[model samples]
Target: MPLCLDPNGNRCSYWPQDAHFVWEKNGQKIETCVSEQTHVLADGRVHVLTWIKDAVVQDSQYCCLVSSKAGNKMSTSYISVEGSNNQDSWSRGFASWKSIISEHDKLMTNWKKTWESCNKKDIV
Candidate 1:
């Protein structure tokens, strides 16, 4: 699945060629849910509605487990950060420029105030 991130956030999931040189064929599976008590099961299947709020880096692995009377299997996939990189990069650049401009404006205002105060003879 593709992971979504806000603009200006450097948290990207770029696929590193070196990282995948060695990987396990089958990995452990994890369940996604809030709590067992909150889980709703119908017809031997679990159905739940939940929202996950957090931040994750690109290429983060997510695993899921499938179980049955026959046997159990595991599946894993990585989140793609390319989706947010380009878009967020531009946004972050703009935000950085804005911060710089704000700082410049504050410096100029202080300089002007100091200049005016010095002109009045009371300023030493």
Candidate 2:
């Protein structure tokens, strides 16, 4: 996390713009309530990031993405948000939920075929 100083050289915080900060959970976007997010220096080096406002420890994803047309690339960092409450465990478990609909459809299709093949009229 980056920290700045006030006019009196007192320590302060900084927040990254919307383009740089993204927070999500279970593939759903979450509120990025933060006092300070990113602090970029003169040389374009991201010194520090502060995310402290309305931030709770849970199974969520935080990403810091930077892209440029010069080459076009991205970077990200993962930090597991764990809470003592242990409330968002079962509902949001997967670290990465990939193609959920496709996976569910496949499972349902197989289950449907099995159910149809077990016709009650032909039951042994």
Candidate 3:
């Protein structure tokens, strides 16, 4: 899976190379299968693409967070394999509330860290 971000806010030419990013799966930080790339479009938008390679095909949630002086933003995506076992799918929906809450808490904590790092400046 791949996530893309446009760091430009009201300022069209702003390029936030110091932006911070974190990727999570099922409320936990992803420690592997992650890579990132940045691109500058002709229209001056700074496009960032983060990819999660070799991910297992399953019903799971993923989140992407980016923080910079420009702003902080988070995006979530749920991946469900098509034609999965009906019983398994039903069970997942029935027991997903706790998982959702846990994920939310983890995301907030990680976002706070990313925000702090992205906003930190030299003490000079």
Candidate 4:
């Protein structure tokens, strides 16, 4: 299930300006890509959306914190570059032990191949 949900137990469709949405990338706060409008919802909640421009430059872990009079909610997402080699793995900041082990295994395999190639002896 998604971290943020509406009273009907559905993913939040429209975020309100009153519910300030703070965005972060790789655990650090991001200040850019903030745009606001004068539109307001029927419930008197101003619609708010946070967009990140050119976000696919690199793999990253992103988080959104929504604070309102009711309570505070947080949502996190791992975004990988479209053509990244390790797209199957989590973002660098949110790497799991599984990915680490996989990377270690790949390195070991490469090292073993190099060692075998270097130590090969020519037969008469």
Which model, 2 or 4, shows the larger TM-score? 4
Q: Each model's C-alpha lDDT?
A: 0.47, 0.50, 0.74, 0.67
For residues 20-103, what per-residue lDDT tens digits would candidate 1 score against the true structure? 111221242223332221222333232322232325554366554434344555556666776556777888989999999999
List of clashing residue pairs for candidate 1: 13-58
**Each model's Cα RMSD:** 16.9, 14.6, 26.6, 14.1
Model 3, residue 13: distance off in Å is 4.3
Query: The CA-based lDDT of model 2 is what?
Result: 0.50
Candidate 4: stretches off by over 4 Å: 1-18, 43-46, 86-124
Best by TM-score: 3
Model 1 gets an lDDT of: 0.47
Query: With candidate 3 superimposed using the best TM-score fit, by how many Å does residue 89's alpha carbon deviate from the native?
Result: 11
* lDDT string, candidate 3, 24-124, tens digits: 98899986888887676767676777878655566788898988788889999988877554767778876897799899999999998887877785322
Per-residue lDDT of 26-77 in model 4, one digit per residue for the tens?
Answer: 9888888854334445544345555565456778898888787778989899
Q: Is candidate 1 or candidate 2 better by lDDT?
A: 2
Error of 3 at 114 (Å): 74
By lDDT, rank the candidates, best first: 3, 4, 2, 1
Better of 1 and 4 by lDDT: 4
Better of 2 and 4 by lDDT: 4
Candidate order (TM-score): 3, 4, 1, 2
Candidate 1 has what TM-score?
0.34
